[model samples]
Target: MSRKQYSKELKLELVKKHLEDEISYWKLGKEYGIEASIIRRWGHKYETFGEDGLEKQNADLCNYSAEFKKKIVLEYLGGNITSQDLAAKYKIHAPSTVRTWIKQYNNHEDLTNSRKEGVYLMAKNGARKNTTLEERINIVEECINTGCNYASTANKYGCSYGQVYVWVRKYKDKGIEGLYDRRGKNKAISQLSDIEKLKAENRLLKAQTQQQQMEIDFLKKLDEIERR
Candidate 1:
């Protein structure tokens, strides 16, 4: 069955009815043709984000810093504000963004790492990088020393500015341990040093250069034989 989408105005009306009229979720679902569970979720989002929580968000439209996400998640968990209210306060276009952050925090997932790097969200194109724990610590420290200059830190570290910003925020919120890569199963870059990474890249470049040189020499020999 095709899922029905509700408009912002409709969602607001429904939530208001649920709240002011104190109607049951089952009754609301029956009246609106939405499931009780869905109504409950809507009610929760309404409490968190308000009317804006009902609006759909464009996936490619925005990128939020890790610090902002952490703050929102913590605030929601703290029970002081709804996700909708937090979204409005932060000027976040999507309330669902807060929902995702809250879910990940509850799951004990590291929010510092971008999903592209196997964290939470899809990586921006060609922007994903493998950074070690030590490197993450250094990056965060440098960002702090530079007054949280994320762009400069990212340039110095050859990483995305967004990634650097996240690392610094995570460090401040969770201390040094937050920078640690927690995935035990996918540990390809674990415990590796910056020097080791550079050396590996250098080795690959040298091998490619040698192969190119060999091809050039073979072409030269072939040309001479053809001239004969």
Candidate 2:
């Protein structure tokens, strides 16, 4: 499924609500059907980069100096900041972009300027490949094991980055059974066996627990940064 797009005006309005109105992220998210983390990200970007940060990123690839990338990667590795904060500070398109750089740095990959911008563009925005269930499982597993580097995993599997991200999210929320193609099927919870239902519930609980812990960590870090 394609990801939903929000307008610039709407994004600004939501950010303002969080910033100016003192509305909680969870309340806004529940009312708007967006994840609280996403809303929080928007607010952070707006704070860091102003209105321009609310704009959708262009598909055109961005080139960064090797030195610049190394600086950010090292800062991230220093454990003083989150990838999302670093992305906002540097005006990077997304936190995932920062994570990709960190992944490359950890793997001893070259952090050279993108001499082949077209290849990066195609890899990021090209047509997604249709893969078998086995391939999807393998891709999801590798993505998880590799620190959830969706960009690299997508390139490795010849799929769109969005595909890798969505698959991993689904796997987290529903387990291995979620990776199956269920288009045009209306499988209800009532139709599931007891074991299947229990497994799905467990997966959902696990995902929620992880999200809660991440939020807690982010808030604690934010407090520390503010104190400093």
Candidate 3:
């Protein structure tokens, strides 16, 4: 799936709603069809670095000095904060970059400013690689242990970033049972408890209702514009 890019204006608007209006991230996420975690991260960034934190980072402008990388890496290793928090605090684009630096430091690898030699600078989109259940479990464990660093985990395991992210999410939502490949098997409603089925249906219905409401509001604005 293609990643969606939000404009700075939209980001500021959402961040304001989250901060000034005291809107909950979960509510905003459901209403706007974005992850609550992502919204929360945006709020943190906005708080830590102001509007500049919400600005989209240009890859060309991401060059960091080796000394800077070492400083951030050491701070992370100190365990005072999470990688996500560190990224927000330091204005880094991705927490995975911080995790990658920590991994390199722990492995006694050279920390260089050269992007060519940087593992974290690899392409975000990569070919999906098939893995055994054991490998998947290990990958998910490492990802969780490393503060959910999907990009670095994906790079280390030779899989796509999406795969690592999805696997980790599934693991969190359903535990070990979620890791099993049930593609060809029937996903019958009988497998779910009554409460589980009802909850799932309610979530779907809520999303649909919200979507319809947005559509109606959009059409109303269009009609009003036409009448003027």
Candidate 4:
């Protein structure tokens, strides 16, 4: 699926809920139907630069000079910050923008007027995840056999909690083939029949709701202790 863009106002609102209310990112992601990683990135931006950090950015703005892109890429390679961090710091439109620049630099291609090679760099330094197809199938099967228990499945397999959740959902929607990465691209939801899309969304909402309940229970315990 193509990346979804959020407005500046929405970003600020979510950040406020995350910071001022002390809500967990995963819960917020469930409530708002956004990825928890995106919420964490917004929190990072808000902490580093305040309101201005949440400003809406678009690549079409063309505000970044070639020199600026080169500088950002160099700093990123220097290990000062991640692509997400650099995007937050510079108010770049997307973290992928910096990733594109970094990919170009690493590939010995020109940074200026460069394009992404359609690789999904989920980690820093353009590292491709080494999770084998067998591993992915195992993870999804385990998650299912465990009643979609993402945390336990992740722990058992040394996978991220979010990764397990995503894998399970994709497996449900498209069978085992859905677990493939497809190199930074996926079949867009628009291509799905209306009923299929609705079913997928309903499944996501149910999983997210369960996660939120767990977080709430944990927070309540913490609150009781604080009041003691």
TM-score leader: 2
Candidate 1 stretches with Cα past 4 Å from truth are 1-126, 185-228
Error of 3 at 10 (Å): 8.4
lDDT tens per residue, model 1, 71-119: 7887776666777998789877666667657655653545553222212
Instruction: TM-score for candidate 3, please give it.
Output: 0.42
119 Cα displacement, candidate 4 (Å) = 32
TM-score between candidate 4 and the true structure = 0.29
Models 1 onward score TM values of 0.29, 0.47, 0.42, 0.29
Candidate 1: C-alpha lDDT: 0.59
Which run of 10 residues does model 2 get worst, by summed lDDT?
115-124
What overall lDDT, based on C-alpha atoms, would model 3 receive against the true structure? 0.63
User: Comparing 1 and 4 by lDDT, which wins?
Assistant: 4
lDDT of 3 by residue, 9-44 (tens): 887777767644558989999999989898877765
For all candidates in order, the CA lDDT equals 0.59, 0.67, 0.63, 0.61
Q: For residues 84-163, could you state the per-residue lDDT of candidate 2 as single tens digits?
A: 99989988767866877876776556776743433442243445677766577678766665556565576677776556
Report the error of model 3 at residue 140, Å: 0.6
Give the CA lDDT, 0 to 100, for residue 71 in model 4: 96
lDDT-better candidate, 3 vs 4: 3
TM-score of 1: 0.29
TM-score of the candidate numbered 2? 0.47
Model 1: colliding residue pairs: 48-82, 48-83, 48-84, 48-85, 49-83, 49-84, 49-85
